[model samples]
Target: MPSGAVRMSRKRAPEPASQLGDVPERKRVSWGILISQGSWADRSPLHEAASQGRLLALRTLLAQVTPVTKGCHANIATIDHVTPLHEACLSGHVACVRALISAGANVNAATFDGITPLYNCCSSGSVGCLELLLQNGAHTRARHAHLPSALHEACKRGNSQCVESLLAHGADPDLKVPQLGSPLYVSCLHRHADCSKILLHTGANVNVGRGNDSPLHAAVRQDSRDQVTLLLDYGANVNSRDEDGRRPLELAPPGGPSQQLLVSFQGSPRTLCQLCRLRIRNVIGRSRLKHLPRLPLPPLLTQYLEHM
Candidate 1:
């Protein structure tokens, strides 16, 4: 249109969407483009970064997700009632947890089985995650399909720290579930000797037995010497009978400290176990002693003789 110089040709516009050739086979990305693309590297980077404690990489990848999709993550299923938040909390993924919470994930979401993320963390000995979930308003009283509560899981796992944290956050140790008795019963029944001690110190029921028997009955059935000792120390009724009329002593071997069962019942079968043991001990001791050469009594033997 002018004489001074040749006019430059106009650039052609981009082809219309319908004119593209099968979308040019869209390059398979190694990482997600908005969502994860068809690239294993894309999916693996997050896990690898997390495993390596690469906080910066994790943050970068997480930040790429658009705000619209932020709260769309779910690691669990409708059938199982679990979520990614639950897994992260249970596995002690502190950074992932923080990211999930910050992304508006539901902290109190329960699994199909009624287990919350907080319960998993407590059961798996993740005190930090437990605290995190509680701080974010995770319910401590949430129960699993078969579990009682976070308190029950903590006690069952023998995690005293988790138990303390749950209690401090207002968990009910005595909260009774339908099948399991109390959190204390869960502790004693699962052979958590130290947990039982803590529960007892906190006024948990000493004789509160669940299932078919009292806690004493459960202790004796396990034949856990430490549990038996603890229960007795806590003033468990040694003579307390279950539905089958069995005492704690009935479950013990003949020589256990509680073998006598220590209570009398009118018109009931008398427990002569102590007399029977004394007779057996005396016969065995005398037979063994008769074979030994006469010697001066040692200090320990003198003490025993004096006690006898």
Candidate 2:
């Protein structure tokens, strides 16, 4: 046991008729006795089994215990309110997660700190778990006081697959978390070019400055030429300034790619084609630009429009 971790004593509760309706008559045993027999960090057997990806053990445990309702009336939680579904999703155990959900676990249950299974799965780069949870009607835009959204977590971890899954499931590409800015900013800061590209194509604000620091500033600070180019293609302001009034050009290292690109953008005027693309995107709106590739245009032109 860890020094500060609390070990709670388990107590038996009456089984819900709705859950036990399918079971045949037999000698009733206290489910709490099975959970209390081990010093397993004060977590129930279902939590331990789900975390370990033990499908058979999870099924047996679910058969014995009452199913969790949508309101989390019967789901097991640790001292911090971390549930079995949280454990399963954190470990990327798809089968265990499905079992728990089929047994009526609350998909949107949050811990004491507001970390849901979707956030945990995204943080661990578990695209399978993410998809399953979304299919089960998990809230895609659930915000946490301290943690960002699942899309932000995927971007921070550079998990492009998870980012795609989150975006396809209706995650807000521009959701700004306190101190984290937006998903695009986090992706640029970490040099996740693919993630940043996805955000931009999915309608993230190109000029959403974080405390006056534009994402272009973050790209320049990280010296990611690919990210910088992508941002500019999406109409990022070249003269954008940061909190200390430092422009991206000033932040770029001399003789680096970012410096050269910014200098070129400053000197050269926009071409007619570039202006047209920007105008079309603006008129279509960021929310609708995601369908640009599916429009009735030539594939090459569509690729150009999507910045592919």
TM-score of 1: 0.61
lDDT for model 1 comes to 0.59
- lDDT by residue (1-308, candidate 1, tens digit) is 22432111011124454654433221111001311212222223544454344567766866777777776542323334445566566556787777667766678887554667777676557788788888988887753445547787778778888987877777765677767777777877788888776665444557776644667777766667777766665556666787788876677666654343332222344246533533443454522433223437676643332222
TM-score for each of the candidates: 0.61, 0.82
- The candidate scoring highest on lDDT is 2
Segments in model 2 whose C-alpha atoms lie over 4 Å from true places: 1-40, 66-74, 143-147
Question: In candidate 2, what are the lDDT values of residues 74-94, reduced to their tens digit?
Answer: 268977677889888877899
For residue 122, what is the lDDT in candidate 2? 74
Q: Rate the local accuracy (lDDT) of all candidates.
A: 0.59, 0.78
Error of 2 at 298 (Å): 3.1
Query: How far in Å is the alpha carbon of 16 misplaced in model 2?
Result: 42
